[model samples]
Target: MTTPQDAIAARRKLTNRLIAGKDARRLAPFLASDVKVIAGDGSLILGAADVLAAFAGQFADPDFVAYVRTTTGVELDAEGARAAERGTWVGTWRTAGPQSGAYLAVWRKVTGQWLIESELFVTLG
Candidate 1:
């Protein structure tokens, strides 16, 4: 059985994954099939594949620099099957300048794995 602590840890790993600015492959295990993402640009993206494609493009750019996420708070349900993670994300692109934002991710336990079901992020100037 997945404990609440394990769920929290999983969420941490997901943040670390983003911070590393690694390949989108690292996201597969943490994202649900129908996951919804509201990016800082205010664009709406749906599904794991679309999300992956978006990142692939982002990561492909050489100017796409560091990506980091810092979780300030996380709340898990009694059953530990659902959670909300709120944090800030800061990124740098070679020429686009810095993009920083606050994010809230709603996670769901799917197939015994805590996967991000929906995420919304807003850019901060």
Candidate 2:
């Protein structure tokens, strides 16, 4: 039996893999319709479409390398309908050194699956 935490962890891993592969289209399913994101650079991205656009734009850059997230923790609410995920993320580029930071993601259970509702990422180093 897969617990919700385990399921969320697996989803996070899959999301990381999709980002690393630059598969923006496939990543859509993981985001909520009204998802929001505050990028590590302090840019605000709203909506699933806009988020996908941001990712597509990033992937189009020739110097773009990869972004990978390592989840440190996942906490669920009492109802088990929502969860908060904390992790460290590292982004690499062909022309620049790697940048690493911490991130927080809020997820909701929708249609029996976990979808990212919002994410706030802060660049530390």
Candidate 3:
């Protein structure tokens, strides 16, 4: 059996893989149906479809990429079923200027799969 710490590490790895591969569709498996996402611009969005659509373009952009500055987070649940991962991330685009910010992602375990329930990001100037 995997430990709570191990589960946290796995979540981090999943995040990196999603970014590196630029696979937005793959994110579905890791997010709950009613996931809530708060954008850096202060937009509050609900539902996985809406959140996924908002990011679909960016994810499909070959020139757009995101890098994680650090892998630091805490397990929110004692069983390691829920967790929060926060760290600085930098995103580069072909048109707009590079943006860096801090992100807080809250994940929950559903039927043995870790899914993101909520995520909030704040731009750092």
Candidate 4:
């Protein structure tokens, strides 16, 4: 039997894989329709389509490397339908130095599947 923690972790793992492959279409299922994101550089990206657009631009850039997130902890709510995921993220570029950060993602079980509702990423280094 898989717990909420396990499910969310698995989803996150798949997310990382999709990102590494630059497959935004495959990454769509993991995000909510209204998914909101505060990028590491403090830019706000609202909605799944807009987020995917941002990713598409990055993926098209020749110098853009990859962004990987490593989940350090996950705290599920009492009902197990919602969770707070804390992780560290690193973005690499071909011409620029890497940027590392901490991120918090809010995941909600929607229609029996966990989806990312929102994310706040802060660059720490």
Candidate 5:
């Protein structure tokens, strides 16, 4: 039997894996079949496959680098089996230059596994 604290910690670890996974390949599993991603620019992306396809070229670029700097203000709702995590990420692409952003990710435990349900982010200096 896992304690609530233990479960929360495990989830946090998984979240980190999702953020810094190998070339974003690890994200393929958690994404729902019909996952919808809304970009910071207000563009609606439909389906996980579509999103992956869109990013395929970018991920292949050797000069495209990304990193998540810090994660904080994590709130877990054990009762609801949902969690909200906040973090900052810095990305540098040789062509596009550099960008830093803060993000809020909402995750839910579905079928005993945590999956990111939605994410919203804003670019920062």
Candidate 6:
């Protein structure tokens, strides 16, 4: 039986895979229908298309390297079958700029697949 905890862990793993996937440039394949991304600057990016446009250049940059150290404080909504992963991502980037931030990602299961529904990023020093 698939418990809520298992589902949450699966979602988190999928999230990591999506970020470090071979084709990271295109995120639509790994995102949910209502995916929304909130940048550190408080910009609300709606949909996969908007996210692609906003991150297209950065994702393709030669100096872009994102390393997710650890993910903790994960919470699951069993009834809604949603999960949230909170963690810190530490890494260095040359094209866009250095990136060291805390992130919160909400995921949902659709068609038996877990996908990121919303994400929020906050820069940390």
Q: lDDT per prediction? A: 0.81, 0.94, 0.75, 0.92, 0.64, 0.70
**lDDT digits (tens) for residues 8-121 of candidate 2:** 889999988898899799999999999999999899999999999999999999888888888899999999999999999999999999999999999999989999999999
Q: Residue 109 deviation, candidate 2, in Å?
A: 0.1
Taking all chains together, the TM-score of candidate 3 against the true structure is 0.80
Candidate 1 lDDT, tens digit per residue, 3-93? 6555666666665766466588777777889999999989999999999888888888888876776777788888878988888888888
Question: What TM-score would candidate 5 get against the native?
Answer: 0.70
Q: Give candidate 1's error at residue 32 in angstroms.
A: 0.3
Model 1, residue 60: C-alpha shift (Å): 0.8
Candidate 6 on 12-32: residue-level lDDT in tens?
666456555525455576677
Worst 10 residues of 4 by lDDT: 18-27
Using TM-score as the yardstick, the better of models 1 and 3 is: 1
The better candidate by lDDT, 2 or 5, is: 2
Best by lDDT: 2
Lowest-lDDT window of 10 residues in candidate 5? 15-24
C-alpha lDDT (0 to 100) for residue 54 of candidate 1: 86
What TM-score would every model get versus the actual structure? 0.85, 0.97, 0.80, 0.96, 0.70, 0.74
Which lDDT value does model 5 have at 93? 66
Which of candidates 2 and 4 reaches a greater lDDT? 2
Determine which window of 10 residues in candidate 1 has minimal summed lDDT: 2-11
What's the lDDT for candidate 6?
0.70
Better of 4 and 5 by lDDT: 4
Query: What tens-digit string does per-residue lDDT give for candidate 3 at 1-125?
Result: 88655675677677667767776787678779999988877899899998778767777776776645354656566666788877776767777788878888887888877788998878785
Measured on C-alpha atoms, candidate 2 has an lDDT of 0.94
Off by over 4 Å in 1: 1-6, 18-21
